[model samples]
Structure formats: C-alpha cells, structure tokens
Target: MSVSHETRDGVAIVTLQNPPVNGLGLATRRGLVEALAHALADASVEAIVVTGGARAFSGGADIRELNRPESGMEPTLPTVIAAFENSSKPVVAAIEGLALGGGLELALGMHHRVAGSRAQIGLPEVKLGLLPGAGGTQRLPRAVGLETAVNMIISGAPVAAGKLAQSRLFDRVVDTDVVQAAIEVAKEAAASGELHKVRDWTVEHPEAAVFLASARTAVAAASAHYPAPLRCLDAIEAAVNLPFDQGIETERAAFADLIQTPESKALRHAFFSERAAGKIADVGADVAVREVKQVGVVGAGTMGAGISMNFLNAGIPVTLLETSQDALDRGLATIRRNYEGSAKKGKLTAEQVEQRMGLLTPTLEYADLKHADLIVEAVFEEYSVKESVFSQLDAVARPGAILASNTSTLDVDRIAAFTGRPQDVLGLHFFSPANVMKLLEVVRGKATAKDVLATVMALSKKIGKTAVVSGVCDGFIGNRMIEQYSRQAGFLLDEGALPQQIDRAMEAFGFAMGPFRMGDLAGNDIGWAIRKRRYVEKPHMTYSKTADLLCELGRYGQKTGAGWYDYRPGDRTAHPSQLVNELIERHSTDIGLVRRAISDGEIVERLVYALVNEGAQLLQEDIASKASDIDIVYLAGYGFPVWRGGPMFYADTVGLDKVVAAMRRYGKGHEGAAWEPAPLLLQLAEAGRTFNP
Candidate 1:
C-alpha cells in the first residue's frame, strides 16, 4: 500500500509512503481515503495526523499519470480533500519536506496544519500550465490574504514554511518532529470540539475590487502567449468575489479548460522531455562513471572561460591553459569579472567570488593538465589547431584521463584519432556563454568507451546541465538541424522577405529571437566561416549570397555594428538597413530570381518545419536516440520557446500529414532536394503516427 495507518494515543497516524517524492497518484489517493475510513470507524481514534514520511509530505500529483485515463479514477484529489474537510475527527497535516500543488491543497483541506520550518510549501500548478483544481484557490485566499495567494498561484514558486508561519497557512512551524507537533495539535483540536475549516473563513481585501481589476489587466498583458496566468487571475478573483463552494467550482472549471490548451500540453511535454533526456537507453545504471575531480580547460577565450566557470561553480578545481601569458591573464580576468558581477547582483557573496576564482589555475604550459581527470579543449575551430592540441594532450596527459573537445561543429572522431586512445576522447559541446546555458551536448565518438560516455553524462548533471548524448556527425544533432533552419532563413531572404519581417513572424510563433537577430547576436562572421568551409566541402549546396555580400562589406554583425540590420554604438537594437535591403534585391536579381511577397505563416512553417524535417532525419540516423531528445536540445539550448514544446512536438501538434504537405508546397518554390521530406516523416505521416508516440 502507498499509505500506512497506525494509531497512537487515541490519534491515528496516517503516513503517505510513496518513495522519492510522495506523488498523490490514484493508488495513493485511494489508500489515503481507505486509511481515513479505518481511523474514523474506531471510536478510540479521536483525531488523525496525516504525514508523508521523512521525505516530501507530497510533491504534488503524479505528473507521469497526468492526462492518463486513470488520472480521473475514483477518490480523486478533490474527493480525498473533501473527505479531510468533512471528517468528524480533526485532521492535522504534518508537512516535513515539500507540500506543493495538490499536496498543498490537501493540507489546506485539513482543520490544522503543522509543518517543519524548513519544509517547502506552495500550490505550484501554474508552472505546469495549470491552476489548482481542489479548492486551493478558495482556501489559500482564506488562509493567506488575496494578494499573497494570487502571487503564489501565479508564480508557482515555493516558499519556505517558516516564511508563511505568520500567514495562518500553518497552525505551527516546528523545528523538530513535525508529525509529533501535528499530533499534539490534532489532540488539542479533538479536545476543544471547535472545527477550524478554511472554507468557513472569508477572503477579504480592503480594496479587493480595485486590486483584482488591476491584477487582471497586468496578467493579461504579461501572459499574452499563455492562457494559464490569466485564468489563474480569474480563479483568484472568483475566490475573492464568489462563495467558497462557487469559487471552487470556478477554479475547477478553469483548470479543466486550461489543461486542454496547446500551451499546457507544450509545457507538460517540455517537463517530461527534460527528465527523459538524462536517461540513456544503452548506458545502464551500473555503468561506472569516471571520477571528475580536477578539470583542465584549453584556450583562454570566451568559450574557455565560461567552460571553466561551470567546473569551478561545482567546487571542482580547474587548470586553465592558454598558449600565451597575455591570453591566460585575460581569461583569468574575465572569470573574475563574471564572478564579481554575480556578487554585485547578490547572486554570490564576495567570499564565494574569491573561492571560485581561487579554484582556477591559469597556466601557459599543456603539462599542467596531466593531473586532470577530464580535459576539455576549447581551442579555435580548425582541424589543424585541434590536431596539434590533441596530439600534445595524448603525449602529456595521464593514462585513462578523458580528453574532451568543446567543439560546436567539428568531427569528434577526427579529434579522437589524433590521440592514440580513441576510447578516451569525446565531445563536450557547451553552447557559447557556457556557464549560463543549460544544454551540454555529450557527443559520443565511434570509439568512445561506454564508461567515458557515462562519466561525461554523470558530470553533466553534477554541473547542472541538461545533457543530451549525440553520435559523432557534422554539427551533431542541434547544429546540423540548425544549419537547415538557417538555410531556410537565408532562402527566405532571397524570396523577398526582409529580416525584421521574418523575425517578427517567428517571434509570434514563439522563438525567443529570429534567425537574423540570433545570427547578429552570435556574430554573423561565425556563420560566414562555416559557409566558406561548406562551399569547399559541398560545392553543389545552394545558399543565398546576400549574407556573403554583406560580409564582403564588413558588416559582420553586432560586433561590427552592421549585418542584415544596422546598429548604433552600445545599442544592440536592429534597425532596418535600406542598403542591406537593396543589396538583397540585387542578389535576387543577379541570381535571375524574381522577388515576391512572403506571408508570415509561410515564414514560420518553413523555418520550424526545416527543424522538424531535419530532426526526423537525425532520429532515422540514430544520431539522436529519441524525438524528445531533439526537443530537449532545442528547448534547453537553442532558445526554442518552451511553450511551443520543441520542433518535433510542434510538428506532432500540426499533424505529420499536414507538415509533409507544407514541405511539398515549399519544395516547389525552393530547392526541391532540400525540401524533400525525410523518409521517417513520410512513413509517420502515412501511418498517422507522431514522433513522440
């Protein structure tokens, strides 16, 4: 049984026993109700103390069970809460760790609640694109004031139990033995015969009408793309204005509506996908991970310094190497500046700044890396540069030390080949500004050992990253797919759409930035170099020369203050350049192509479907293990909007058949081979299957 019952001194102690996190799934809910019935049946049991063992009181509803048919099974959260509220015997909630979402609602249903001071408590359904369904909206407002309750419901961030002790949300905030305190409270309640129900209290504000109206306006403006926040505000308004029971019905009805929205579905998909991204099908739990204690980072450039910060923040000592003393000094200064900036922002203390900086050892010689358990080379993106670095690392590094390359787009196998031990080499592709970005693509080379892959994957979590394993391929999973997307963006430029138009359409579709804006921010010269290489590597690959012409004029993006858009000094804003527009027209004319107006809808579909089609190809080639893995990569790394899920999930929402049809239409206008739907997409479309399913 998920729940257990034991009576002590006329008080029935009902314990939720679900491990890890006590998710109130169907069995747990039913068990809770059954335990309650048993306690009420005995006249000797005058009161009940509900506790969720030593771990979490309850983390909330079982997210894995969400949307399943069994989720609505009898003794649902509402039914369970109703039992607690109506129980003849006083029910006291004993919260030890976390009481969140439905868990908090369960606590609110009880007559009394006693929590450990350190316990976390909240109704955080808004994060899952939901509002609380089981009387939380009504009762929370009654316990805490309308403003506090609304803020808690909207933000979905947990507050420590100690923070809410004065809010009447908790009957007692104890430093020790929460269940014992709850038992005492329940015993006292049983003796007093006074029923304290949150439902009986009135939700009041001095100027409730004014506050609620202002709140509704604010939420509507902030949550234009999301429907849940506005719905949450509406629920809170109902809590303040309507009767207790009517407010509950209002909240439930709103929840039922929001749960079915595409926004909610996307958020839920993102949540599950991130969790699934960490598990490798082939790498079992028993796979031994190499201990990564001392780490070495080569190249004291922007990428190198950021990579070093991740290890330092995790309390691992780092030996940062650069070819020149000046370079090494510059890198160390940047690292210190970054930490000092954090300290200034109140995110870190002065001692923490010094402590993290103290972990970094700047060196000019490669010999210092001999003791590193893992060495990540963040040198320039050149085959020759990488070859020299790896050859030297192979000679100087200790046996069994993992040699990793932080190459965004290069052959990991080729880098590994430079070293005698190919099994010890792999790619740890950290996105630019590595310390800030969460995605770490663990590129597994052909000869990479299982243990090495396991070690890197394990280390990824230690440093707080959502690691996705990728097979060695040109650009790996994210960039290879992004290349196609960028190609489509360039094609759109040739087809008569301006940069800002494409950006606005994509922003509307939920990309944080359009391709042009992103290119500008990341330095357009990077893509120029990649294209130059691609031109020699694959001569037949068609690409728009508009970008090359812009580069020819030295408009290399934000660093140069000009590219597809003009920028003033110190301002990153992209103002439309008439010169660039004329240049694009000239390029189109020179290529013997006529410019025509393009719709925003076409722009969104082409760019997004480009990612989806390439993602399907990656899945087919097994470069990516699963479709959701690709989604996680984009969601965590590429600024793909979380509310749209990822490209694959969005494709599923659009229906594979429709996506294929759109690709066919785009194929007629653009390069036909480039737009040819992937075989997997065609097969899935034919069978009416989704990538996720």
Candidate 2:
C-alpha cells in the first residue's frame, strides 16, 4: 500500500505511505492516482489533503527505478499531476521534511500548497543532470518569482517553506502539524468552490529579457563542463515567455533530450555508484555496528588535523595525539584556522566555532585514548612508523576499539601484524584534507572482523563520508588505479606532450586537474618518492625519467615555486616552465624515441583506459567486488568529473568494444605491454557487454 486513505472532518487524506521519503515510483504513482480518484468519487469527502509523512513529503522519484520499466511506470508522474489539476475536489499539498526534485514538482501540481514552516522545497533534478519533467518549470515560476525559481532549479538547493510562504507557492505555512493545516486549507478551498491551480497563475517579471540574457552568459561560463544547468535555465526561460502548456512542452522536451545525454547518464551513474559503494556484500545488517562515542587520532599533521575535524563537526569528542607539544599546538591551530575560515564565510558563527574546537583534547600520551571506541593513526606513510604507532595503540586501546591506519599505500595486513588484536586493525585511508573529502577507503585485512568493517561503514555515514570497502592491496582502490592513470600521463610527457596540453585535454574531458597539475599541487616530491620505491621493487616496470630529472634539479612543486609548472609566491596558478619542457624533450631523446604531435583524444583515451583496464584486472583479482565500487573511488576521491562518471562507467558509456579497439591502437604506438587489455576487459568487450551491466 503506497498510499493510505482516511477522512478528517469533511476532507479526505490521501497520505503517501511510502516510507523513507515517499519516492514517486511505479507503485506510488499508481497508488496516488487511485487514492485521488477514490477521494473525488466519495460524496462525503468535501476536499482532499495529500501528504507523505512528517519525516519527508517526498525526496523525488525513486532513483532505483532509473533505466528500468519502473522509471516510466504506468500512472506516470505527469499523469498523476494532471489528475490533481483536474480533480473536482480541491487538492492541497501538505509538504514537510524534504520536497525535492519530483517531490516539489508533485506539490506544484496540486490545486494549492499548504506546507509546514520547516519544510524544505526545491526542484533538484539538475543534480542528476536533468530538469524537472512533470510541469515544475511551468508551475514554479508562476508561484515563486522567476529569479528565485531559476536559482532553486539550477542550484538544486532547498529553501524553507516559511521563506516562500508569502509567495503564491504556498496557500498556508504552519508550524503545527502540516497535515492538519492542509486539511483546513483544503476545506476552505472547497468552501470557496475554487480549485486554485498553480498553472493558472501567470509568471510576472519586470526585466526578464535582460536577466535571462545575462544569466545565460554567466551560466555558460560557470557550467562549461556541465550541460544540465544551462539546459535547466532554458526550460525555466520558457516559463517566463511561454504559456503554461507551452512551458510544460518545453520542459518535457528538454528533459527528454537531457536524459539521453552522456552527461546525464554519467551523473546518474555517479549518484548510484556512491550509494552502492556503502553496501558491503559480506557485512549483513545482523553484524553489530559499534557506537563510536569518542575518537582518537594519533598524529598532529595536516591529515591528523583534518581527520579530527570530521569527528568534532559531528559533535563527537576527539583526543588528538602528537609527540611534541609544539606539533600538537600547530595541529590545534590548523583546526581553528579552518573553522574560523568557515566563520568568515558565514557558514559558522563564532560560538559554533568555539563549540567544535572545545570538543578537541590534545594529548602527548596514548593512555588518553583508552576509552576511545575508534582510534585512527594518521602519522606517516612508512612501515616502521605505523609499526610503532599500532604497537602502542594495541597496548593502550580498549579490547573492542577499532584501530585504523590512515596509510595511503602501505600494507594494512602487515600493520595489523604489529598489533595483538589483528581483527581491530584496518585501513581508514582518507584523502588529503580528510574532513572535506567524502571518500574513505575502508581497507579490510585478512583478519579484519565483519563487525569492525560494518561499524566503520556505519560511522562513515554519521561523519558524512562515502565509505567503500576495499580488500587489502597496495594503494588500496583509488590510489592503485590512479597509479596507472599517472603512468600514462608521464608517458605522454615523455612522448612530447606538454604539461598544459595534457592538463587541458584532461580538463576538457572533465577532470578538475590533469596528473601534472595535480602533482604540482600535491607536491611532485611525494610522487618522486613513490616512483623511487616502485623503481626499486618493480625493476622491469617502464617509467619516464623526465620527472626524476626535474626532482633531481631540486624542483619539488608549488612548495618549491616550480615543478612541471611555475607558480608565483602567493598564487596557485600553474605557469608553463620552459626548464621542465626542455627536460621532457631531452628525456624523450635519451629514450631513443622520436617526439611527435599527440592529439587530445589520444591523451584522454590513454589515461582513462589505463584506469578502466586496471579496474577490470582488480575485479578479476577480487580486489574490488563491483565495478560501481571502483567508479565511486574515482568519483569521490580522485576528482573524476561527475559528468563523465568514473573510469569504468565512462568506459561503459563509450562501448567496451570501442574502448578495446582504442586501447589496441594505442598499444601499437607506445607501451604496448601496459595497453594490453585485462582478461575481464577483453571478455566483456568480446561479448559486446559493459563493465557495469
């Protein structure tokens, strides 16, 4: 029963009973139509009050229905909205909690809207790279002003109902039970004999032409990589110039076109992939998740400070440990600076900043962490350092406490060996600036307990992170795959591709920054050390010596004012360095290779396919269970553009057979061994199947 029916006074209550934010899916859409019909037929019911419980009126269409029969289910959202507009009895929406995307559109479709003061409303389909298709663009502008509606639609952020209550969007906004308020509004509308529809209202704007023209310019510049926001504005523009019916036609047409777009498909893939990464197949709901009341972080560096902020922001007390008092003070100062920066931006108040900082307890001893339910070591990326930290943690931490290492590429299994309780040891690899980054790779060691895995995954949600479970491997999931992408980038440089050229190509493909730019930002010295280690361990592996030559000349990166690109003392902008370009040329000559012009297509194909190929191999090796999990790692941590999805999803988008063909073409050119498709990749390509499906 997706919808439950009851009568209050002379009003019929058609409550959307779908739990967890009544999503407008197949069952719910059919149920809504049936409930409305029943209400309209009943002579006893004077008016109709539609609602979806207090927790959420609706979050939108169930995304689980995407690309399925359920997505275009019978009694579609359009059909349901039409029913509300044509209803003989007055229909009023009782909106509360979240009325986002399709949920907000459903509310606009009713005769009138009666919302709770706290209700958050917005059309957020643009987040999934699509515009609202169910008459929202036509109706919302007629209710709220064009500027407000356009902003809401494009940004996909919600506004409190109280703020928009003065507008025609809401008939009434009450703090007391929204359903009761809606019933009263419905009765009044019925008494007046006016089923006031949102569509009937005209959109009024004084300078619509000037505003839209300027908006088009601004959005075009800001959303060059993303097509949805600009498309969203076009649909909204129709609401201003065109009639209600015409606007709807425009909206639906735009939605249809956008839905088929690769960008939209990619965004949808990323949305689903992020959620999929949280669910570990082996860890069932029956596995007990430990309550992490107090947290301990065993370092006072940048990573340690950032990790501590996550717990502090979540209102959980944290004990931050460092060897020296000066280091502890520096870490505490860094945390305050971050919080104060937020305060300056009006994201936090002075009181809230102090409140969060007050929760931090700086310590010089491990004994202070005995009562902590979870302890993370964010020290250094060395085996000896981790052994020292874990051994001390094993001695001092409570019996059931989860001990985690924040190692980017170190072996988690060996780190677990340093501790007596191997089951408690796992890797909680947070990217740099741990608090801000959403990806938390939960590396499960051979001895890692299911409960330990489940607890960390559950805790990740509380702290606002997408936790993906990874089987123990060097570089884990994101770093491991990125290693290949970086290798291709270096090889591209060795083959005469300039730093900016490769970066521009990747940027055009929707990467935030190319490997060289990222390396410069993250410090080229870090990769130099990793490559140095890999060169010793993997003697037969091929690598371009251009980066090594640059490092040897003592050019680190932004920290040293130069690396692949030069930077001004205070600015982060990457200016091309002739010194590095000359080094790349010399290295190409030294390798006995003829330097040639490389196309942007070649750069993107080589780098992204490198990821796709390695991801397939990881799947075959059982390092990753699902393809979507690999996508999530790149999407969340590695700055893979949301519009391109992750490497695997993007490969699926390009057709695996085509991807394989392109890889073979590149293999014939350079690094043929690296370009050889993985067994799983070849199998899927030959079968004319995708990595995801």
Hey, what RMSD does candidate 2 come out at? 1.5
lDDT of each: 0.92, 0.89
**Pairs of colliding residues, candidate 2:** none
What TM-score would you give candidate 1 relative to the actual structure? 0.97
What stretches of model 2 exceed 4 Å from their correct place?
A: none
lDDT of 2 by residue, 1-693 (tens): 999999888899988888889999899999999998888888899999888888889998887787788778678888888888889899889998879888888888888888888889988888898888888788888899988888888888889999998998988889998888888888789889987888888788899989989888988998877788888888888888888888888888898899889888988888888878888888888998888999999998999999999999999999999999999999999999999999999999999999999999999999999999999999978899999999899999999999999999989999999999999889999988798998999999999999999999999999999988888888888888888998899899888799999999999888888898999888888888999999898887787788888899888889999889988989999999998888899889988889999999999999999999999989998889899999999888889988888899889988999999988888887677788789999999999999887
Please write out the lDDT profile of model 1 over residues 141-196, one tens digit for every residue: 89988988988888898989998899878899989899889989998999999778
Clashing residue pair totals per candidate (backbone < 3 A): 0, 0
Candidate 2, 587: how far from true, in Å? Answer: 2.1
What are the models' TM-scores?
0.97, 0.98
